[model samples]
Target: MTLPDTPEQTPLTADTVLRYHLCWKHRDLDGVMALYHPDIQYHDFFQNRVLGFDELRDYVRASLPHAAGEDIVHSDRIRVDGCTAFIQYQVTVQGGDGLVAFQSSEAITVKDGLIWRINEYATLVRRNAKGSDRSSPRPATSRLGLSPRQLSTMAQDLEHYFQRQRPYLDPELDLQQVAEASGYSRNQISYLLNQVLGQSFYRYVNQARLQHLLASLDDSCTRMPVDDLAFAAGFNSLSAFYKCFREHTGLSPKAYVKQISLRART
Candidate 1:
């Protein structure tokens, strides 16, 4: 969309780029979006996403909160050539209590006093996960010697193996066995589950077991006892089964069965 015809609506220049950066810095999504042409095309290389204004708005809405920050832009230098402006800036965003600095630039094509096209690139300059300063380097041995990529890959591999082999069906299944089977070190496996997946190894396995138990429950015609069913789903002890069942369903097996039964009848 075009800007209102006013003295403030100058042709594309360094000032226009500064205004755009200000809109982002102030978290003024409306102002930020208004700068785009009605036929604007935005491309994000890292996400490999290309979209028009409608989809662009939705993407920005979802992603801005994660990336937005105050006084984050460096506007000391900007290059303007013809109808195109190239802007260089650094943005510092808060990730938890830590700060992440991204060196960024954008190329804008202006048509008829409005921003028509924008191509942006961002590079991670520094990441401080512990709210530390530049005095110390990011740990090379973070997460107990496992890099973020390695942990992510291990987590994926573990999930894939469990889904395909249903290894949690073995009541005695444990983290060490998972580590061996998944070909990741035991510590790496533990980190993948506890840190990345946000659950203990047993808890992750038990959640899968709970899903299996629920599927069996869905077949209301099954005559199998709940305890037997729990055993078949990899619960070696009655206490573990009861605890996991209550946590997962927020109801006892009997209550769950009754609830589903009533729903079926209704």
Candidate 2:
């Protein structure tokens, strides 16, 4: 919480942290690996795991953003003391009721101009549609070998799989199927959907199905009955389709189709 009143190693610590930050920002795995001290220790409190130098290479690589411009907001405050620096940041995943993110902080101890120790912490925050935020002190799921960034990436990967493969178009689709298809374990996928993104796996799949039907509705969808379209989009039952439709569009299927027709006429 507090640093030295007058720090001597502030400049050296600042330089080391800055380089480390830049290496991460640029996604240079080699550069990041080069900065780690041979005896470095990384403590990830969220995962309840500690990784040493030998393990950090793969861990850091897994934790880096896979896609460019992913939402990682670093704070302006990078505090430094004799040989330690504290940094704060947030990694946001673009889904859920509103915005779901992890408020993450790190304490870095530099030794001999290299990163010798790191203590990392993360808390999950979920913001509802009404603009209120609910946060968990630490994630309910632990020791999963996933960082918050990895969870974010997994969410994106799941979305992409749905978009490209249209896996939700199968009426009998299940979580195990998705897990296998997406190359993630069933538990990992479940946690990302339920805890991080704040929704059930079926709810997420139904949302994809609804989106598929909505796209069809936007383009000459009147010829086919909405119920038929719902079935085509993978809803095995009418009741489920109607609920998903109403929750997403705030209207029954018939009303939505009628509104689309009216827009076409106008």
Candidate 3:
């Protein structure tokens, strides 16, 4: 089906962008896909995925379901330049007494009045009603009788296990194994990581893996290829490793290595 281009051939505006955003929030797959050009290129840099129209459609369909009952909080600022637009928003999902917000920004390119290309990045945040201060001490989970000190100790022990044992380097390492080894229930571990440490299990693990990778980089004698280094650091996918590395260090691996080399010379 062919969508009509704007009569005046005007670039996409905030209104046009909102139509697409609203369609996504409402989980209207057809409406979402209708705004895309037939030859669309969708780039999810975090996933290291570049998808065409068919893959884009499948991804949108699969992802929208997760937003079915969630609230979409859109930033008021939508910046448009020529045929491109930038938008930011957060998808808030219920998490026990609080909410877990996945915030994302998209750079969209429009052609012939349809979305021709898109690049998106996302991060997470946690929020609660009454706007409680996140830095304040958290109350113990009702399910676990452990005091704050006990939870803190468990978090530290878990960190030590992950760092010294390098279980994160195992692509198959999972919460169950960690729990079994540490004598903590999976729920308790998850609660400690999420509620106390303010991160998900995978997020904490990946951060550890990224740190491990950096330590390897620090060893000038290390001769492993960057990809091998990433794998050895326990990242299952190269894309995921790159994403995590960039998120943690604010630079890609190659750039980071170059910076380190220059610093050593200086």
lDDT of each: 0.65, 0.87, 0.70
The window of 10 residues in a row where model 2 has the poorest summed lDDT is: 1-10
Clashes of 1: 1
Please count the clashing residue pairs in each candidate, in the order shown: 1, 0, 1
In the range 1-266, model 2's lDDT, one tens digit per residue, is 34343477889999999999988989999999999999888998888888999999999898888867878999657888878989999998865657899989999988888998899988898887788888855558565788988888887788889999999999999999998999999999888877788789889889999999999989873478889999999999999999999999999988988898899899
Task: Give the TM-score of each candidate.
Answer: 0.48, 0.92, 0.48
Over 96-198, each residue of candidate 3 has an lDDT whose tens digit, in order, gives 2345454668998777778888987655455656764243343343255333223434655676677678788888888899899888899888876676556
Q: What TM-score does structure 2 among the candidates reach?
A: 0.92
Model 3 score (lDDT): 0.70
Best by TM-score: 2
- Worst ten in a row by lDDT for model 1: 134-143
lDDT of 1 by residue, 1-266 (tens): 54343434434455666787677666677888888779888755433446688876665553343233332466556667766778776554321123434455778877665677888665544434565544322222333533232333344456678878999899999888887887877876665454434457788888788888889989978879889999999988889889988876789999998998899998
How far out, in Å, is residue 37 in model 2? 1.3
Better of 1 and 2 by lDDT: 2
For candidate 2, the C-alpha RMSD (Å) to the true structure equals 2.6
Ranking by TM-score: 2, 3, 1
When 1 and 3 are scored with lDDT, the better candidate is 3
